[model samples]
Target: MRHVIGREEADFVFIQETKSKELSDARCFVIWGDNNVGWIHNKGDEGSGSLLSMWPKDVFEYESHVMGTGYIAVYGQHLKTSYRCVVVNVYSSCSLRGKKTLWEDISKVRQSSHVLAWCICGDFNAVRSSNERKGITDRGEQKSEVNGFNSFIDSNFLLDLPLVGKKFTWFKPDGTAKSRIDRVLVTEDWLLLWPKSKQYVLRREVSDHCALVVKSVEKDWGPKPCRTIDAWLLERGFNRMVKDK
Candidate 1:
């Protein structure tokens, strides 16, 4: 984890399923490779799952945080952009019912804070499409799961950025099952600031799940592809405006 942070030159980090019950400042500083680091760590569900979020204190100004059922969110302003935003670090439940509650919790947080620029990243433990999973034992269950997860992203107006580096983020020990459950999702306002942002899946070192990093590196291809969210079609007068245009 330390090596990845250093090599990637990360300004922020989100770690899920951390087994440690408590994290010391010394360990956090060591992992971040600096004393100037701010973070929030959950007590975890009996050491089975915990989230550790950290950022360079010099880069991002720490304001306040809200600790919900399964997530931790921090509100701060970026020193460089002076953009006040909320970055939610999540470690959602594996079960569908529990996942729904987690989604509601996040939505309420976003609503209460009224901060539109958001960058949510972590192990969702859910997939958005059927193709994202392989060797699934229950096709019916998987389909239902996909629908629920997709609905959450669409209804919240969160953009699931294009993935880079790997097709599957989780691999079974025997290589029988593989799924793309880890992701980084940002709201439309956040996307406007960085249109080319992408989710990068890093190498799985000493862990079953691959680490995910969100990066925005601009590139110019010959003809760019059109990108838009589906919710726009449901808005009143959208169809007429498109036809008139």
Candidate 2:
């Protein structure tokens, strides 16, 4: 995970299925290196799921909104561009009802966020079309699930961000089955801010799911700018502003 983040030069990262109950600050440092990160995590019990969202504090200021075994939403703004957004990371369950609940939960988060711009990305654990899966015939139940997933996306007004790479994001260990169950979705408001941004599915490593990255095409015309720090929040007025919100 550390290698992928560093190589991609990502400002934000969302991870699912961490499968750990707790992660210390030191572990966060090791993963993010010198990025000055702030994070929100949902710790799961042994043999279950966990979710994590981390970003460089210098680049973005974030507040956690919702934390679930399958998802985490962070509302933040890019310090340099001052572009506001709410980013959600998801890792859904295999159970049909669980997947439906996951969709509804994310919809709630989107509706509640003050930020108009939204970006959701992660392993959905479900597909939107028959073409997304291989080595298994699409049964009636599977078709129904696809329709439900598509309806959720449509109702939320999200556009599926195109990925550059192999079609399948996940594969069985024996290579007998594959599916494009991982993806990124963004709202029209977000697309307006970064119309040229693109998402990619990197080659899979140890995990069955492939590594993903989203790169915004917003250009920097000048030198790099300054960053924010925890000290700034210590100011009398700034502290109050945070609390009042």
Candidate 3:
């Protein structure tokens, strides 16, 4: 985690499913090694499903607004721009019914706050499209679940940030199944602060899920280059498809 943060030069970070009981201020500083940082950590049920959101105090002064079962809401003011915003870090339940209830709870938070500059990001454990999932699995993403997730986004008036670097965010241990279950969603007001922002699904490491980072691009990185996996080359007509392209 420390290496990723340093390599990415992240100013803020949200970690879900921490699977830890307590995170003291000293431990938080060790994660970032910055004394000027402020963080809010929500302990999970006995070392499982925890959450932590940290940011540079100089960049954004954050105040904890609410602490849900699997989420944390924070109201922050960007010291540089004086822009106030709300950030919700959620690690929703695997059950569809539980997720729906989580969405409803978030909607209420949105209603209570005057700030429309909101950003929600986490492991939703749900997908918006069938294309987001790959391989055989019994974790059937029901239609009602999809509709409820979409409705929550639409009704709340939030926009899903486009993902880059990878198609899937989580994969099975044996690498058979995969799904884009984690993401970052922000309101129009938040987009106004960073219209050129892009979300990148970083490669997975020890965890089953991938790490996501969203940032504004000040310089063009050029178009993404095409590359094919070695496994695909063994498939019949794979060479022909590449030649045709």
Tens digit per residue, CA lDDT, model 1, 41-155: 8878876677788888877899999977678898998777888888888887888777888888887778777788888877778899888889877746777778888888887
Every candidate's lDDT: 0.80, 0.79, 0.80
Q: Candidate 3 at 33: error in angstroms?
A: 1.4
Candidate 3's residue-wise lDDT over 100-135, tens digit each?
988999999998899978888888887887777788
Using lDDT, rank the candidates from best to worst: 3, 1, 2
Question: Which candidate's TM-score is highest?
Answer: 3
Q: Can you tell me which runs of candidate 2 are displaced by over 4 Å?
A: 1-8, 137-140, 218-245
Candidate 3: misplaced stretches above 4 Å? 1-8, 138-141, 220-245
In candidate 1, how many clashes are counted?
0
Provide the TM-score for each candidate, comma-separated: 0.83, 0.83, 0.84
Q: Highest lDDT: which candidate? A: 3
When 1 and 3 are scored with lDDT, the better candidate is: 3
Residue 200 accuracy (lDDT) in model 2:
77
